[model samples]
Target chain A: MIKAEGLTKRFDDNLAVDGLTLNVERGEVFAFLGPNGAGKTTTVRLLAALIAPTDGRAWVNGYQIGEDNINVRRSVGILTEAPGLYERLDAVQNLTLFAKLCEVDDVAGQVEKYLRLLGLWERRAEPVGGFSKGMKQKLAIARALLHEPPLLFLDEPTAALDPEAARTVRDFIGEIKEAGRTIFLCTHNLDEADRLADRIGVIKQKLIQVDSPANLRHSLYGRRVVIHLASVTEPVRTAVSSLPFVEEMQQMDNALVISLDNPEEQNPILVERIVAAGGAIQFVNELRHSLEDIYFALIEEEDRETQA
Target chain B: MNGAKIGAIVEKEIADARKNRMIILSMALIPTLLVAMVLGTTFVMLNVESVDEASLDEDELSMIPAELSGLNPSHALLILLNDQFMFYFLLIPMMLPVYIAAYSIIGEKETKSLEPLLATPVSTSELLVAKSLAATIPAVVLTWLSFIVLIIGGYLIMPEPVFLAMIRPVWIVSMVLLSPLLALLSVFSGVIISSRMNDPRAAQQVTGIFVVPIIALSLVVLAGKIFLSVWMVFLAATIALAVDCVVLYFAVKLFQRETILTRWT
Candidate 1:
């Protein structure tokens, strides 16, 4: 539903988003992960056609970003980081205003439906200024979805929400995905991305590292075998390292952590060697890095490269 | 730049203005105060039985123009009130432009709603024109309404010859036609200033400075140092309208969403 090639944005001397390419398929939930100033928001704005690119081009739903901006805007919904709501207007009024602007046929009905869906029906009449952060965020979502656009751009939708509210937003996002809507989410929340994204893209310095969470995890640590030993003694550690396929061994408290090139065939031999060395084995399992670990590792690698 | 979208924005702005009872009330109250002040001064001048010689100290007397000195107290008072009326009405063109334009742009910035509004399918031309009209229309209406009241009050207190002569085609054109054009100029200027400054008050204060020249013109008229010819007034209005177009063009050019998104202000 979205395509970009060598997309870049420069502000005077600073390059905010540079030479980044990304593609999101229809009905896919794509999470963009980056630190505070890693050009995530800039990328979202570029995709939304809210700003002209300094170079390259992007297409949303077949409409070129800057050239066919109006058509692209009509086909997409955007929820910005700060929610950007008119605080003086009530939730219902805010939704209705945007719905009408989007040229919805029946604005009042759409407003009612979205407010009820977001569980904001009760507070629809209260000024948005009086709402909590979570409420305002939900209202922003409702505004974005009012016209039922095929694609959505959400920037930090769940940033300040409590666990329950955050879950509600995540679930709503999941529902949108299930209903076959493309979502481009820009967030710093790794857990949120891990749970909701089909593919996660880590952006830093205007470049992007895009892969599935599982593949990223696999690439970060390769294949490894973890053995849970009742005790970690010098003999047990030495014995595990002596195995043919065992590349490295470290005693992690009571657990013996081993890294190997291939853990599938070497697991049995490693366990047998540990047993033979008189080390009591409690359990043996393969270790895979989580999204958080992969993210930090990639960022660390980028920092090292820049420093060098 | 579809009409439906512009209409939607205008409708939303009007509804918002309505809900803020204070804004509506203040808009209404300002003109009423102008009417009251004009009529009250006219009545006091026409009806006062005797002059307080003490009230006209040397400083106050010197402030009155020498040309107006030979006239009776009522005539002199009418000239003075006419000048004050012109000065205060100049402010009318400024009121909605400065207040609404500043609030429209800077308020959106403060509330963080500007980016989303720009992100929508609405064209820049539509958005700018809608806001400019929204601010300019009400101001022009209020200025004309206030002038009507001033004319009525002038008729009741001033002598018949002066009253009939006061309601001239040129005077009516000045109040009705020229006032709105000036109001548009001020509104667009205010919008441009607010877009750049981000501080609503400072934008307002800076735009408010434009009224200084008009106030000074009023003072010159009151002093009888100059009488504004109809041609001169028309020329001034034309110049203001041209300036409006120029400022509006810059406003559109500088209104790039990228600058707003990147700049902290």
Candidate 2:
């Protein structure tokens, strides 16, 4: 639903978004991960046609970013980092105003649907000035979805919300994903992105890496499997290490961690050999790397590379 | 330009204005002050005979102008004061909208609401035009209403002949034509300033400088340096119309999405 090629935005001498190129497929939840000042918000603006790219080109829902700007703007929903709501106006009024701007067929009906969906129907009449941050953010999300655009660009979807409110927003995002909509999510919350994103794009000034969560872990640190042992004996350890698929092995406490290539296919062979060697197995699972691990490693690596 | 979007923006701005105590106070109090000034001047004109005419000579009365010299002292004073006070009507167009247009965009930026509003499909042209109308409509309406009160209050106290002369073509054109144009000038000028400045107070203070020219013209007229004729009113209207077009063009140009988002700070 969204494509960008060499998308660069330069404000005088400072480059905000530098040569970002990526394609997000339909019904895919693509999460963009980066450090502070990594051009996430600027990229969202360029894609949404809120601001034109300085040198490169981008397309949203089949319209070029700067060429058919109105169509592009109409085709996407954007929830900015700040809620950016009208505080003096009530919740319903804010949604209704955006609905009118987006040219929704039935403003009130569209507003009612999203407000109820985001659990804001009860406080629609109260002024937004007194609303909590999470309430305001939900209302902002509802405002973005009021017109029912096919693509959504959310910048830091859950920046400052409490845990419960963040979970509510995350669940709502999952619901949106289930409805077969394309979501371009920019978030600093690694756990939320790890759970919600179908594919994650780790970026800093450029596209560092893009892959599925599992694929990213595999590509970063090959295949690794963790096995819980009833008891570890020198014979079982020596036998497991002798297996050809076992490229490396380490014993931590009562568990054995072994690194292998293609563990999904070779794991049965390795487990059978361990069981045949009188090794009583209690638990066996793949050693999955969390997104936080990959995120910091990649960022630190990039910083070192930049300094070099 | 979608009328629905423009209308919605205008409607929201008007609603906000109604709820804003500072804006409401300025709108209400400015007109009341104008009314008080008008009425106080009218009462003094009506009671000019009670003052000592012996102390003041005919030269002071001759300052009223050769054409208006045929009238009695009270009548001449009413016509003189009425003609010079027409300049005060210019303040309405320039003053009221400054309070409003000064806060139009900068207020939203400060409140962090401009981003999402800009993210919508509404273009810059539609947004600026809607804001211009939002500031201009109320100002022109309140100005005309206050002018009507000033006129009627003058007529109630002054004699019939003086009232008839005061409500001539010049003041009519000034109110109907010149006032609205001046109000547009004020609004667009405020929009231009607010587009560049972050602080609403800074925008308003800079926009308040525009009133200097109108005040200067008022002072010149009061000093008997020149009398305002219908032709002069038309000339001022034509000049104001051209200036409004230029200022509005710059307002639209300077209010770029990137500039507003990135450079205003």
Clashing pairs in 1: none
lDDT of 1 by residue, A1-308 (tens): 99999999988888888898888999999999988889998899989998899999899999999899989988999999888898878887788778877889999999999888888999888989899887888889988999899999999999888998888888999898889999999888888899889999998855647988877877777777778888887888788777767777777889977888777778888888888888899988878677888888888888888889
Candidate 1 is scored at a TM of 0.89
Of candidate 1 chain B, the 10-residue stretch with the lowest lDDT total is: B161-170
State the DockQ of every prediction: 0.64, 0.83
Candidate 2 has which clashing residue pairs, if any? none
Q: Rate the local accuracy (lDDT) of all candidates.
A: 0.81, 0.86
Name the TM-score of chain A in model 1: 0.89
- Model 2 lDDT vs. the true structure? 0.86
Worst lDDT run of 10 residues, candidate 2 chain A, spans: A201-210
Give the native contact fraction of candidate 1: 0.80
lDDT by residue (tens digit), candidate 2, A21-121: 89999999999999988899889988988888888888899999999999998999999989988788899888888999999999989988988887888
Deviation in angstroms for B15 in model 1? Answer: 2.9
lDDT of model 2 at position A81: 89
